[model samples]
Target: MTYKYQLIFLGDINNNACNTIKVRFFDKIHSIGLRDNMFEIIYNETFERKYSNKQPSFVFYFGNLNHSEKDIDILKVLLDNGDAILPIYFGDNFEAEVPKIIHVMNGRQYIADHIEKYINYAFESMRLLRENRKLFISYRRTDSSAVANQLFDAFVRNNYDVFLDTYSINPAKNFQEELHHRMTDCDVLIQLYTNDFKNSKWCNEEIISANQKQIGVVEIIWPDCTPDIHNLLCEPIQLTQKMFMNEDFHNGSCCITEECIENIVNAVESVRARNLAARQDNLVGEFVEEARKQGRQLIQEYRYLVETLKDDIIRLFIPAIGIPQSYDCFDSLRFRKLLDNEKIELFLIYDDLRIRKKWVEHLEWLNESLEVKTIKKKDFELWLKNN
Candidate 1:
């Protein structure tokens, strides 16, 4: 499968030349045994139509063997816009001295043999661009809206791709699904923590899901309120609430503020640098070894249970029902709207475990108390079976 990021190769080639180059490149790519889906190669002569559909971070130009100053200047322009060029020379018949800008590969075979090294460099550049390009903010509706908005504006002002709710995903049909998708896809998840946020089912779900997906979670904590740290799996960056309220919040020591947004940016950059360094140190190989050990441990522990569960379990869905005050929120009308009128088995959490009770006395009492037809778990299932 193609990754979230893609590679596009832009260079000058005639139809026959393009075919020959593609064949050579494809054979080299295959011989190196790299993943086929990781990169793409494109060649177009026209500058305007070069990358009309998708822009490439790395560009390799071939056939600039006899590099004139003009050719070097052109190569510099391509490199200036964050691209790498690999120039291929056919024969050493050049009387003119080659400029330092040209990377003189001996032949197609020489280029093919060292292709892996060039691609690795290209991939590293792509990774750095992805890591530094954007910041995504995730927040609950009830708490710290103003602060979140301010942070969003500040990040945008710094030319970061700020994906706050207003400018990010559109609130169309299946908006919740889109929200979850984006939450998982984002490089960072900025969480504004408050007591009300804990109470929100969607907010709690987002936080837990984001943590499980291994996205970076930065929590901006509220003053005078201790957040339930145990419930949050990721380590959160705790920023004082008073810091945000100050007009000089930017000047504070906290990294999230405007004046220190550079600090925050630098912190992320430092992390990227360190991570790259660790990868260079073969830390990823060590991690893989550790992961293999853990996998073996898991297989030993859950061998039978996993086999049994695989056979027995069909599907599972956990529906959320808010507190007694919002019992009406669980009415048939709302359930129908939420589930798109699909038939689903309903289970209610009773006594801290899921139960199949036909008629919940508490729900009936709630209907009587509020004079509304409160939808019990049994009622929902029965409605599903009948319809």
Candidate 2:
């Protein structure tokens, strides 16, 4: 559903040298474990999609400085939009115009075949800059260290990036800033509930922060004690005695036994699923706003599964506004281009396909991997609601 980057190649399609560069760049991309279909080659396409959390990294590849006027304009627009650009150039045509801060790869050695290595390095750099999925531990360190340590080990073994204050904090970092970062950035917070949990200054702060940020919280009720819920934390999962090794706490040394690990896993999964749904909601709103900005009339869109194995894909249609000169406008161009740039396949409905056959053909041709369905306008609202 989300990727680390949307690798976009932006250069002069007419440049004779770029053919080898394109082939080798794609070869290297696949070789580095990046999927080819995920990458966008913006040759004749317009820049339409907004760079957001789903596609956080917007990478651009400009082959040479000998770009067309339109290509130069697009490059400027990309720079303005804050997308990362990799300008592969050898000559001094637009070198002075290029910003000193932009990411540029040397193309003089294309004959030498080292462009792929530099491209790989740039992509790796982009990936390293992305924030990793994290889980934060909120516990009373002095009282719950034993259980926290075990949970930490379990999470690590399960391949979760965890932020336990005792293990995560560094001496050189500012305590407040680092703690805030961890609390806000984490996907889930496992609150190891103890008698001292609400009393600790740090624990209380962590709970409030998690609540304010809307981060998911799993309450692991140690010794089966009820934490005072005056200041409500996020929906909590209470682990009972049957879920653990023992209810007997001879100075708080108990182990999680039977179904408790699964309980924690299920809670995390639920939170993740909810988060994914929320993200889709946000994306739907964004796509609608984008379409409206281009003055296209939205018939309907469905947020439903295209396949059980894949995440939900949106299907929307923009019909002709019924004006005589509607065909000459960027309304359709802007609408379809936005979808194409994002590689989103949706059910498109129209008054007549013959009116925009060329554009429809281009859209279908470009995204051969995507499945498209044509529907009547009468089914729009019903499809949206049911989906």
Candidate 3:
């Protein structure tokens, strides 16, 4: 998962402070289960301006009174923008310089004694925020009951919130309705395919339902039989009951070995992640299409209003079109080329109010070279109101 927070480590490399923070702090953070690539270390002050448009979640600065004015300015800006600041002052001179608005925490002391606590707290917070685990176990009870039970028990032991019809469905409830409900909500379906799996009507229905909902399916092949690839929900993971037995596991066991369980867990998690990403991409595509439709409608409405205002002398500023996009994305580059050297105002209408520093750089280039106007949706509305 992509972390929403951006952690910045600003310090002097000459004194090896940055190295200590990287090795002693951030590495341990990742090892202790926080997401990787969630932060960056910046030793140079010149590049700090690159973050002027987007605020970081937290800033850690290790320096004394001799730190550059540029670094101080960056820290001040970060603190002012509601970001947390951890300042490590080598001497007493800079202690008084820390802003009152930001809670001043000694970075060196925290790294030495309380880094693990802080890191673990952060990890727990992130886990709670991203807790969306819905697993469905699809198995042919008549053929693979033993292995299926073992897999289900293993997953429960690992604290996963999963759905197994044997465990999840109540005797009083309508079985088919409850089963469909569980399958619809599942993020990933783990299919335990035995020799007679395809012959089972219920198993085929489950697979078809999962496929129709666009949920991910992970097949655990217990039999020598291969499922028809064209009809299968997703790629099948071939695993035999003998493979588990080869590792000193027996038929009577209630659960599989830890290694086997870990492998299954990793596979399920990987497919679950893919399912989430695919859904998000589909949502973004849908949003872009709807935005384009609305933007064109608004343009047509405004154009008609302009024509009505000036009957014969209606001199529109060329025939520029506005595109709904993020500041960094200019997918209409070829379309823009079609209006080359036109007097019309080419407005890049952004989706949101917040703009990134990288986007500001892109916009600056567009303004100087292409003469395109970069405006937010709110600003465009304001222009329409005033005009």
Give the TM-score comparing model 2 with the true structure, all chains together.
0.41
lDDT of 1 by residue, 1-387 (tens): 112222333333432444555565456545533334434444443444433222333444444333333345545554334233444333454223334554322112224455555454444444432333456676655455666677776655544466677677776735665566555434456666666665677756766765454445555555545767544563455556445535223322322456444444444333323222222222122322333444411010000000012333211112221122234234423423433423322222111112112224555555454423333333433432342
Q: Which candidate wins on TM-score?
A: 3
Locate the minimum summed-lDDT window of 10 residues in model 2: 300-309
Off by over 4 Å in 2: 1-132, 230-233, 241-246, 250-253, 279-387
Better of 2 and 3 by TM-score: 3
In order of appearance, the predictions have TM-scores of 0.37, 0.41, 0.46
lDDT of 2: 0.49
**Cα RMSD for candidates in order:** 20.4, 19.2, 17.0
lDDT on C-alpha atoms for all candidate structures = 0.41, 0.49, 0.49
Number of backbone collisions per candidate: 0, 1, 0
lDDT by residue for model 2 (1-387), tens = 322344455555455456666677667655533345444454536455533333423343444443323356655554433344545554555453233333231223233366565455444323321233457887775566766777777666554678888899999977776777556556577888777776668666777766554556777766546766633555466666565565643244556653666557556645543442233333333334444455433322111212111363333343221111223233334434533434444444432212244444554454453344443333444544454
- Select the stronger candidate by TM-score from 1 and 2: 2
TM-score-based ranking:
3, 2, 1
